[model samples]
Target chain A: MKSLARRLVLAVPLLWLLAFFVAPFAIVLKLSLSRAAMARPPYEPVFNLSDGFWGLVESARQFTFDSYSLLLSDWLYLDVYVSSLRIAGLATLIALLIGYPLALAMSRAPAHWRPILIVLAIAPFWTSFLVRVYAWIVILKDEGLLNHALLGMGLIAEPLRIFATEGAVLIGLVYAYLPFTVLPIFNALDKQDSALVEAAMDLGATKTSAFWSVTFPLSLPGLYAGALLMFIPAMGEFVIPDLLGGSNDLMIGRLLWAEFFSNRDWPMASAAAIVLLGLLLAPLLLFERAQSREADT
Target chain B: MPRIGASGFAALLLGFAFLYAPIGLLAIYSFNASKLVTVWGGFSTKWYWALLDNRLLLESLWVSLRVAFASASIATVLGSLAALVLARHGRFRGRTLFGAMIYAPLVMPEIVLGIALLLLFVALGLERGLLSIIIAHATLGMCFVAVLVHVRVKMLDRSLEDAAHDLGAGPFTVFFTITLPLIAPALLAGFLLAFTISLDDFVLASFLSGPGSTTLPMRVYAQVRLGVTPEVNAVSTLLLAFVGLVLLTGAAIAQRMRAV
Candidate 1:
């Protein structure tokens, strides 16, 4: 009876994940191999169980890799993938540059004030993400706050156009994801013993040198975690680019959305999504490995 | 500890300013009397009043609240159960696979998850609506709850449970009388986090929702794309105020519980 109870506890959530989580990916895979059509449901069915086992064998034989081949042969698709990676990578780098010092400062704050600093860091996150991105539009548009302020200060005669550009998208991405970068790095830096840094200084290393040699290396795991957190979502970001990017900006997420919603090409969109997931799988697996290793230690 | 250098202090100030300035601008503009969001005609409460009469926006807000509540509650139960299994059942078969499944959704791009679930709904002949949105959000939210609850469960002292077990208590009884009380705060935190994520989600909710089930984020996104208006500013300000209140209340409750 005890064993049965234990089994039941495990089975319930495992089955829930299988039904909702794992099965969806399988469906995406199957849909990606099918042919697009104009009919309702929009893709040729991948399996036909009506004719029994032989029917299944026959259907399996009819699966095509044409969609994937199209992705390779078309330069636009490849370009879109590369551009997505570049934008996401740049945004992650910028976020790290801005986030690291702030996190380091927060970690080194006086003990009594640390919680308040952490709360302030996280408070902005509770606001709606769309609203935050919208806030940027208010500030960056042609007649916006930044331009108005610059004109008033005689910084520039012309209204500097920053909206609907790659720069705008970068700012939106960095602003939206900054907290994700800060929290992990703070966790890592905060947990480190201050004695290690003191010891390095005791050995006659300057503050900067001790930080580089002792503190920075120890905080690598947090940096990596923060980068991955920022990069993965930024790669597949649709809202940021759609709202902030120019009409020609063709990131994979926007391309996928266009293919699915506007063109109504389920097979093509699924193919692109599968490829995007494949590109992300490496870093994700590395993250999972690191996490389990941490747990073990 | 060493005091922060002047440069370090400046960096911290700049970072906080960068984070808070845009949000502050939004809040300030919400009260502007001008229809043009950027122009400051004067302060007024007209936009707040306008939000009350906007039927579509109000309806979408109601739908988002329902979905957030339903998904967060369900995710909490499933996630807490998964946490228990991971914490107590040390060497179970398929444990690694289970752990992987729980954590995978955390890093999976929302766009991919959105598309994958949309396809799943279509394949199953399920109509896309509130039910579909709830299912998708719950699946996504549960991973976060699992991560949060798992840490709390691991940090719990095992001796208390062992003592209860030795004193004529069954597993279920010990779980209810001891374990449940101990992990309640973590559970509440997990639920609030899940609710916030679900409420704020636009991508997943957009893909899964059909016809009348549009969420507030979806509505806000559609409007924001066309142009910014003071009405959006007012709605956003109200949302910010609501979320801030909930967060403060949650923190206060947690502090009081800890003190006791």
Candidate 2:
């Protein structure tokens, strides 16, 4: 009875997840393998639906590799995926470059000031994310603040076209996600054993050397955590590219959005999504190890 | 490390400026007297006053408020239960899998999930509207709550729950009376995060929202897409203030919890 009660406690969440989370994704996965039969409002699938035991129904389709084959054929789709990957990769590296030093400073600050630092790191999140991105549009436009300031300072005679450029998208991506990197790096730094650094110093190692040997390597847990957090989202980012990039047609997310909403190719969208989900599955498996380290202290 | 060189100070100042300039310009231009948003015009509160009379903006904000309040509350309750089970129980069959699934929604791209959920809704003949959006928000916000509550549960001493059970309180009562009070800060944090996400959600709202069911972010996004306006600035300032207030409340809750 006791074990049964405990099982009930566990089963509630488990079943809820299966029904809503796993089942939906499975349906999508199944659909990814099947072709869409373009019918009227109630579009039919090219699959026979038969009731299975346990009150579940399985789709009966002469499963073929056709959807996968169709998805891989177009060089247009491949190019978009590669472009998005490159951008997200660079954005992740840029976030690290900015975030690491900032986190180091925050971690070394007096204990009394730590909360203040944390609040600042989190303050940006409080604002609406879309508004924050929209704010960039105002400042990066040709006659916007950045160009106007440059002009007024006599550095440039004319306004700069900072908006609708790849650089603009990068700036938006970095600015939008800086805090994610900051928090993770800060957490790693906060948990550092100062004693090790002191020992390295006492052994006559220089401060920089000690940081390189003792501090830097030890903080990889948080840094890795942050990179995964930021990079994964950046990979599939739709809003930044859609709003900031003049060349929006070069992103997988944009393509997927177009395929589903604009082209009305449901099977194509599902195939694209399945591929993206496969990309995500790599980091997601790694996230557990990161979480345990984060949760400790 | 405490005192930086001039170059360090300059770099810090530059970073801060980079962070603040965009939003600051938007805030300042909200009060600009001219119709052209980018032009440096005279100062006025015309947009703020105009926003007050905007029926579309007001209606959307009201819809957003109702949805956020409903979704956040539901997510917090269910998420708390899940968190308590995960953090306290520690091990069950498929515990690792369970934990991963709970947080999968956190990292899953909203565009992907929105499309998936839309498909599910379509397949079910469930029309797109407030109901669909609420469930979507709840699914997402539940992850934040679970993570937050899990953190709090990990931090708790835990022996108190055992003591309560030994004193004859059943599992349900022990949870309600003892465990709940201990982890209240996390629960509060979870609710605030959920509420804010639901309030600020745009991408999912755009996908799933029915006609006239647009949320505040959707409203702002639409207005901004048409072009920059002073009304957007005024509305953003209000949003900033409301977010500031919520953060303060969340901080106060954390402090009060720590004190106890």
Candidate 3:
């Protein structure tokens, strides 16, 4: 009776995760292999399995790889993949550039101000993300604050087309993900041994050289972590792109959303999503390897 | 980088401005005497007053509060259990898979989870609304809370529990009376962490929320789409205050627990 009750307690969580967490992914996977019957009320998922023994690949289950082929053949999906990569890439670079210096300063600063600055760094996120993004909309509108201030100062005669553009989207994405970049880097930098920097400097290395040789390597764990943190989400982010990207900009997140919602192609949407999930997890696995290597060293 | 040097001070000031200006502008406009957020006429709280009576917005806030509270509590219990189990039973055939699954929600694209759940619910003939939102929020929140509680439980001297068991206590007694009290601080931290995330979630809520179940963020999203009013600022300010209080209470509890 005791063991049975204990098993019941443990089984509750396992069952919960199985039902809600794993079920959704399984549903997606199943939906991907099947076809979408858009004609029905509340579109039914169709998996034809008429062919005995050959049904898995060809006979049934809409065995034609048409959706995958269609998704792959489209130039737009490729564009989305490329654009997501490029935007996430640039955002990661900028975050590193900006975050590195701030983190370095925070690490080296007098201990009194460290916690305050750290809180300040993260406070922006506490405000609703949607609201923050909307604030950007307010700031970057054609006849908005930036232009109003510029026009008042006569910096330009006309309002700038800052909103609903590529630049605006990138700015929003970067702003939102910057803290993720900073926290890890700060943790890494703060824990770095100062003696290493002093030792390099005593050997006549310039401050910059000393930093590159000693401080930077010591903080690689955090650097890699921060980059991975930013890059992973940035690569797949739809919220920022949806809110800020111009009509022409077709990032994969938005593209995937349209596939699932607008196009009603369950198979194609699942294929794209699975591809995305795979792409993200692959790099994460590499990060895990890197972590193990660092531990070994 | 060192003292109150000019360049260092200037850079620091610039960073502060970069962080605050956009948000400060929003707060200011929330009380802006004019319709356009960018336009400054005078100071007024008309928008704040307006939000006081909006039935839809109030209902959404109530729904969000219910979800956040319930999900956070549920996540705490499950996560604490998962933490205890994982820390004790460190390796199994699917340990890495479980770890990955836990971490997945923390970093997975919100859109992916959102649509995935939507499809699952539709297929299962599960209705979309508050219940689905609670389940989804709890899933993500549970992952983070589990990681936290596990670390604390693992770091603890397992001997303490062994000692209790040796002294005639059962495993259940050792867990409840000995283990649980020691890790209470961490449980509090994890719960607060989960609560904040549940409160702030928008994308998942957006997908799962039905006509009567729109959450606070969802409402703010729609309102902002119409146009950001001081009402949003008021709502946001209220949320910020709640976070501040939760964080303060959590820190206080943690410190007291540590002292004990």
DockQ of each: 0.75, 0.52, 0.50
Q: What is the TM-score of chain B in candidate 2?
A: 0.93
Tens-digit lDDT track of model 2 for A34-139: 6666663223353333444422333444445566787778787778778888888899999888888778777777678779778778778767788788888878
Q: Tens-digit lDDT track for model 1 on A46-112?
A: 5656789988888777678999999988998999998999999999999999999999989887788
**What DockQ does predicted model 1 obtain?**
0.75
Task: Report clash pairs, candidate 1.
Answer: none
* Model 2 chain A weakest 10-residue run by lDDT: A40-49
Task: For model 3 chain B, give the 10-residue run with minimal summed lDDT.
Answer: B1-10
lDDT string for model 2 (B151-198, tens) is: 888888878988989999888798789888888888998999999999
TM-score winner between 1 and 2, please give it. Answer: 1
For candidate 3, write residues A33-71 as lDDT tens digits. Answer: 666665642334343355455554452444445667767
Best by DockQ: 1
Best by lDDT: 1
Locate the minimum summed-lDDT window of 10 residues in model 3 chain A.
A40-49
Error of 2 at A148 (Å): 2.0
| B86-172: candidate 1 lDDT, tens digit per residue | 888998788888988998888787888999999988888889999999999999888888888999999999999999999989988
The candidate, 1 or 3, that scores higher on TM-score is: 1
* Candidate 3 local lDDT, B56-87, one digit each (tens): 98888899999999899989988887776677
Error of 2 at A42 (Å): 7.4
List residue ranges in candidate 2 displaced over 4 A: A1-12, A41-59, A62-64, A290-297, B1-14, B253-260
